[model samples]
Target: MPALTVLTGAATAAYSAALVARPQLLQRPAGLARNRDARTLTRLVGVRDTAIGLAMVLAPAGPARRAAVGARVASDWGDAAVLGVALRGRGTWGKTVGFAALWGAVCLAALRYDER
Candidate 1:
């Protein structure tokens, strides 16, 4: 579980950094460059993900860890919901949903570990 947490944390942090540093790189299915509003939202999402990753890494094992994992799960679900609504009937939506599901599973496992 600790390994899962570390891996997810690193991946999310990297993703967030990439979004901030080179938002253009996350084009295509992401479609973040479609408009200024989209780009702004993408940056905000990056910031939010960075915070989640930080929480996962810095929180001690126990309730604090559980809370961090819980936050991840919540945020992932929220992203899934938004994708479902905004990207409906699109291949990108499906891909994003799959990614969210994988992260959600990892966070759930971490939550269970923190419980013990």
Candidate 2:
């Protein structure tokens, strides 16, 4: 479970880095307008993910790590909600929301195995 948490955190951090570096990666896929405001928002999300991911990766086992995992799950749900609404009816909407929700579920499941 700890290994899974680390792996998930690493993946999240890497993806967030990509998003921060290339907002178009997110915008183009989601059918969002490739504008400055969109880019800024994407970068902000990236930053948030980065922080959460780092916490998951670096926090020790037990309460601190569990809290980080909780934060990550929350973030994923938040993304699912915001993106689901923003991209509703678009082809990418399902994919985006599904991914977020699925990832959140994975993290939620991991919580059971988290050392308390």
Candidate 3:
């Protein structure tokens, strides 16, 4: 369980670093044409994801397991979103199944340390 938690946390942090980078990359390209508020919002989302990821790895317990729990949940959330966008409506149902599987994996990691 501890190993699972550490592995997930490390992976989560790495994922977030990528998430944060994508928007910054866009800010120079097509992002130059995008609405300022929308761009800011996108960057904020990435920052939030990155923080949650770092938190999970650095502080996994005490006061609140919420951050750690949320870290994995956030990763799963992004996975589902990507799958949804990639597939669109007619094919989205398959993406949903994939999301469910991903969620299940996250849940297993969460449950492993969910002493509460």
Top-TM-score candidate index: 2
Tens digits of per-residue lDDT for model 3 on 1-116?
46455556566566556646665443342223346675676577567656765666677465345556555575666656654564456543464547535753774566466545
Q: Comparing candidate 1 with candidate 3, which one achieves the higher lDDT?
A: 1
Taking all chains together, the TM-score of candidate 3 against the true structure is 0.52
User: What does candidate 2 score in Cα RMSD to the true structure?
Assistant: 1.8
How close is every model to the real structure, measured as TM-score?
Answer: 0.84, 0.91, 0.52
Please give the range of 10 consecutive residues that has the lowest summed lDDT in model 1.
Answer: 25-34
lDDT of each: 0.74, 0.85, 0.56
Error of 1 at 2 (Å): 5.3
Candidate 1 local lDDT, residue 9: 71
Q: Between the candidate structures 2 and 3, which one is better when assessed by TM-score? A: 2
TM-score of 1: 0.84
* Residue 16 C-alpha lDDT in model 3: 50
Off by over 4 Å in 1: 25-27, 113-116
lDDT pick, better of 1 and 2:
2
lDDT of 2 by residue, 18-94 (tens): 99999898788778888899899999999999888888889887788789999999999988998889888999898
Compose the digit string of candidate 1's lDDT tens values, residues 5-114. Answer: 76677777788778766566555555435577767777788888888888887787777867888888889888888777877777677777777767878878756654
